[model samples]
Target: MSTFQLPSSTATTSTAYSSDEEDTLPYPGELSRSDFLAKDFNPEAYLSSLGRNRHQTLEDLRSDLRSRSQLLNQELLELVNGNYEEFLSLGADLHEGEERVEGVRVGVMGFGREVGGVGKVVREREREMEGLLVEKRRIGGEVGVGRALLEVDARLGEMEEGLGIIDRDEDEGDGFDEDDEEVGGEKGSSPVLRRLQRHTREFLLLTRMVERVGSSHPFLLAQQGRVDAIRKTLLLDLAAALRQAKAAKEADAMLGIVRMFSDLGAEGEGVRVLRGS
Candidate 1:
C-alpha cells in the first residue's frame, strides 16, 4: 500500500509539528516590548531581580554607608569650626601680648631720658615692663600651638567632606546593576551613573592627597620656630629691664649718677637687649 498523504494534510501536519517544537523549547526571559510598555513596573523589584542576576547586593548597604559618611563629615566639620574659633581667640591674645610688649619697649626708651627726678619713676616702669615681656612670650607660644591645631582640623574636615561625596555616589550607583541587560526598550548605558562613579573616585583621591600633605606640613614647624624665637627675645628683654631698674636705684643713692649719665647712657644698652642683639 502506498501511504501517500494529501498535500493539504501534510502541510497542516508540518505546521503542527513546528508549533509543538516551539512550545517545548525553553524561552529565556528576554526583555520585550510588552515589558517596557507595562505601566505598573516596579522599579524596586526590577532592581532586586537585576541585582540577583548580577551578584550585586541590596541597596541597604549603600544607604547605610552613606548615612555613616554623612555623620562623620558633619562631626568633622564641627570640629574644624571649633578649631577656627580657637585660632581667632589665640590671635586676639597674641595681639594683646604684642601691644603689651610695645608698651614695655616705649617705657624703657622713655626712662633713659631721666627727666626731673624721674629716676625712681623709671625704676618702677622698668619693673612693670619686665612682667609684660614675660607675659608676651607665654602668649606667643600659645598662639603657635593654636595655629597648628587649626591647620590639622581644617585638613581633617576636608577629607571627611570628600568621603561623604564618595559615599553618596556609591549609594546612587548601587541602583543600577552592571550585568543587567537592558530590559524592554531601554536604550544605551546609564551616563549619569557612570559620571557619578568617576567623580567619586576623583574626590577620594584628592582627599587622600590633601591629608598626606597636611600630616607632614613644614609650615607649622616654621611657625613654631618663630614662636620660640619670640619667647627667647621676651625673656632677654625682661632681664634687661630688671637690670636697668636696679641700676637706677643705685644711681639714686649715689647722687653722682646724673640723669644724663644714668638715664640717657642706658638707652643704647636697653635698645640692644630688647632687640636680642
Candidate 2:
C-alpha cells in the first residue's frame, strides 16, 4: 500500500508535449490526427470542403481541444478516486473467479457443438445439390437427342409426300454411256430430274448428321428403318432419272447423273444404267 501513490493531475496537465503536438505544425487543412482518423475520412476531399466551411478559426479549434482534454482528465481522475479502495483489494476479490471462467468455457463448448451440427447440414445439402445438377445435365442431353430425331422424322415425311409425283414410267429405255459431268455445270436440265437431285443431296446430308451422332445412338437406332427406306427411295429415283434422260436423248443429263452415282460410290447402280434396266 505504501508503494502505490495516485498521480498528480496538476503535474500531468503541466507536462510538456512532443514537438509534433504543437498547434503551429503544418497539416492538411490544419486538422488534428484524430479528425483524420475518423470514419469515412478523406483528407483530399475534406481539405477541398474546408474552403466552403472555414467558420471555425484556428484559435477556436485549439481552445475546444484544450477544454475537451481537461474534461477527459478530470473524469479519469474522479473514476480512479471513487474506486481506489476496491482497485487495491481486486486481487483478493478474485477467489471465486475460476468458477465463472469454467461457466464461460462450458457455454463456448455448447456453441461450438451447435456450429458443428450446422456445418454438417450445410455439407449434406451441398452434396445433394451437386447430384441434382449432374442429373439435370444428363436430361438436357437426352432432350437434345430427342429433338434431332424429330427433325429427321419431319424431313423424311416431306420426302414421302413428294415421291409419287416423279415420272417413273418413262424409265424403261436404252442405256446411256456412263460418262461423268457435274450436275452443277448443266442449265436447262429437266425439272423432274432437278428436284430428284436436290432431294438426294438433302437425304445424304441427313445421313451424315445421323452418322455423326453415332451408329449405336438409341434414338438413331430406333429410326434406322425409316431412314433406310428414305435412302432406298432416293436411289430408285436417281436410277429412274438416268433412264428418263436416255429416253429423251439428253446426252448431257445422262452424263451428269452418271457422275452423281460415281460420286456416291454406287458403281453397281451405274452398272445397271449401262445395262439398260
Candidate 3:
C-alpha cells in the first residue's frame, strides 16, 4: 500500500472574519454576533476555567515553567551581584510602612471614572428613549396595538420597575449621612451603602437591557430617559441635604466631609456639597 497524506477539512471553524469584511465592535457589557455564534463563548466560565487550570495545555505548562526558571535565574544573578542585601533592606523598609507612606492611591480615581462612565451611558440611553417616544407617538395613531408594540410595552415595564427600585430605596427613612461613620462597614454590611449600590446596579442592568434591545424601540428609549432624570434628581437631593446640614451650623462637619470627598477624587460630588451649602 502507498502512504498518502489526507487533505484538510473544507470547513474553517477557527478562522476569523475575512479582512475585506467590515468589523463591528460590541458595546459595553455586550457581545458581538460572532461571540454568540462561537462554540465556547461564556466569558465568566472562561475566566473561571483559566483561574482554576494549573496547565491548560502542554505549551502553557512549558511556558509557565520557563518563566519561573528565568525569574529564578535573574534573582540568583542579582544576589551574586550583591543585590540580595539591598532587597532585604527594601523588604524591611516596606515592613515599617515606608512604601505605604507615599499616599498615591488616594488620587487614583479609577472607580469614580467607572461610575461616571456608567452615569454617561445612562444619560445617553435617556436621550435615545426620548427619540423612541417621539417615534411611538408618530406611529401609534396609524398602527393600533400590535405584537411589536406589546414587546415594547413589556420592556418599558422592566425599565419602570428598575426606576421604581431607586425611588423606593429612599422610603426606608434612615436619613444617614453620605459620609456617615455607620455606613463605612465591610462590603454588604451597611444598609445605606447597600441601597446606593443597588440603585447603581439597577441602572446598569437597565442600561444593558436598553442597549441589547437597541435604539429602535421608542418606549424603552423614553423610559431610559426618565430613569436617568430620576437618578440625577436624587443626587441633587443629596446635595440639597448637604446644604441643609451646613445651614444647621454643621459647617465644621460638612466642610470636612466635602473635603474628604474631594480628596478621594469625587470632585463633582464635593462641588455639589459646596453648592448645596
The candidate that achieves the highest lDDT relative to the unseen native structure: 2
What lDDT, from 0 to 1, does candidate 3 have? 0.54
lDDT score, candidate 1, position 26: 52
In order of listing, the candidates' clash counts read 0, 0, 4
Better of 1 and 2 by lDDT: 2
Clashing pairs in 2: none
TM-score of each: 0.19, 0.51, 0.26
lDDT of 1 by residue, 1-277 (tens): 8897779989999999999998887543433435434788875786566556543345654664467568769988999999999999999999999999999989977776656358778788899999899989988876865665665445433333333422344434333445453332123423322322332333344335435545345654444443334333333333444355455554331222122123323445444443456
Query: What is the C-alpha lDDT profile of model 3 across 187-251, one tens digit per residue?
Result: 32334333444444444555555555565566656666665664564355345545765687666
Q: What's the distance in Å from true for residue 39, model 1?
A: 99
Report the C-alpha lDDT of model 2 over 1-277, residue by residue, as the tens digit: 3776457875565554444366656543434547756899985787566645666665776676587678778988999887886776774566567678889999999999999999999999999999999999999987877787777767666665556423334644212222333255356766665666666676777787787667698877887887777767767777888888888888888887887777666878977876886
Candidate 2, which segments miss by more than 4 Å at Cα? 1-104, 165-187, 217-219, 247-252, 262-265, 275-277
Q: What is the lDDT for 36 in model 1? A: 34
